[model samples]
Target: MISVQGLTKTYGGFRAVDDVSFVAAPGRVTGFLGPNGAGKSTTMRMMTGLTVPTSGRATIGGHAYRDIPNPGRHVGVLLDASAQHAGRTGREVLALGAGVLDLPRSRVDEMLETVSLTRQEARRRVKDYSLGMRQRLGIAHALLGDPEVLVLDEPANGLDPAGIHWMRTLLTDYARRGGTVLLSSHLLHEVEVIADDLVVIGQGRIVAQGTKTELLQSTGTVVRAVDDAALERALAEAGISSVASPDGARRTEAEARQVGEAAAHHGVVLLELRAADGAGLEELFLTLTSQTQREGAAA
Candidate 1:
């Protein structure tokens, strides 16, 4: 439902987003990950046609957002700040946006409900909104036209844990219904749970993109084991092997569960198993981003 090719965005001499490209397919949630200042918001803006890329293109269903007829109905976007007339009620604000695209007013009411803002709450002036309420209003605006593709940047920024959980389920459910969801957030663990795929970037360039398992596999190793000696023997017979460490602390968190599952099937009492890559994702992200930053500096 979405495609980007060689997307490049620069401000002055510094590229905020460089050569970044990926796709958000229908029926899947694609998590866009990067550290702070990695140009994630810039990339989202470019995708929504809010900001023009200095080079390359971002398209929705094969058409550039700018050229797409009735873009409001084709793409839904919630960036960092949502602009609404404070004096206007939330319902009025969403209705105004939907009206511009000639969408039915019922869609506006439906969105308000979908985002869980009741009719009375939706009637309250936006200026009275809390941060979480404002966020929901922004989401309501995006869903005003029932767009096929949704792009949200740091959507969980001001949300409480409950709100964040709600957002996760909502986005996942949207994708499950064949809509395309592209979300950018710093919540790696949350992404790891709901995202079917990930696109990781640093210093404005995509360094990785794939299913979380695929990306995890590249940055680390996957250890599999069976609890039985026979299963261990089977793995050996199948040519699967793991490195032995004196302390047996090698299994990285990424592969620990898989390793445990493997060990259980084999009936082998696994004393230890771990990813050979040997580090938590927090460390992995730091190493990866720092290395990219160093490369950018040297270049």
Candidate 2:
């Protein structure tokens, strides 16, 4: 398991990560999400000990990452797929990693196969590899030690649809075998499909974190009327509160039936009325982080 408790990182007056806490439990894949500049990378850096935190801590199992012996054997990390040595062959890269973990050289071949990097491709220098190939090589290196925990940041960045599907299957299977996976990505749909839980961050703080079901479950009804002002007034008179959604529709905690009745009673022309059941991760992510994005845009 990975436990991050009140992890905060500050550079001068700027707080890159602030009081972030979440758990990536064993046998589960936790998707870490945030918009641009919302500190997703910073938090991941802290967890992997790439950056020092101003306060709090992050640990794998019960020990800090730095304290773990041969950490690659216990926690596999791939924070940057393109950070590999440009002069090294893909095979050479994994070989060096295996050496660091004191694993047999054969482990390099095993991992290359596991990530679908053919022998011919692995023989080429990393500098000549395309982004997708680099991603495959990075994943191969991460799995070289067969670690119990995996922390990957944007592992799907350069993958095609088929490659993305392959990655999803691989990580899900890894978790099924009782390993823990913490994945950070901007690919909302991919995350929605594979993540068992979610941690949403904005402005350097955790805005929300929970099982995917709990966070994505419908909280209300979404309705849009030809006369939006009239609909709002009607709902207000009925004591049902509502907020305007990003798309100009009104979302209310009341049931769809209740919203419909109120609109009908007020002679409001309804254009759309539905339960918010399938809003999905994209909507939830935007709603949770919208304020931070607006602030960022303003600045």
My TM-score estimates for the predictions, one after another, are 0.76, 0.85
Native-to-model Cα distance after best TM-score fit, residue 255 in candidate 2, in Å: 10
lDDT over C-alpha atoms for residue 296 of model 2: 30
Candidate closest to the true structure, highest lDDT: 2
How far off is residue 202 in model 2, in Å?
Answer: 0.8
What Cα-based lDDT does every candidate model obtain?
Answer: 0.75, 0.89
Which pairs of residues have clashing backbones in candidate 2? none
Question: Model 2 segments beyond 4 Å from truth?
Answer: 221-275, 294-299
Candidate 1 displacement at residue 158 in angstroms:
1.6
Q: Evaluate candidate 1 by giving its C-alpha RMSD to the native, one decimal.
A: 9.7
TM-score of 2: 0.85
| Candidate 2 residue-wise lDDT at 251 | 71
How many clashes (backbone atoms < 3 Å, residues ≥3 apart in a chain or on different chains) does model 2 have? 0
Lowest summed lDDT across 10 adjacent residues in model 2 is found at 290-299
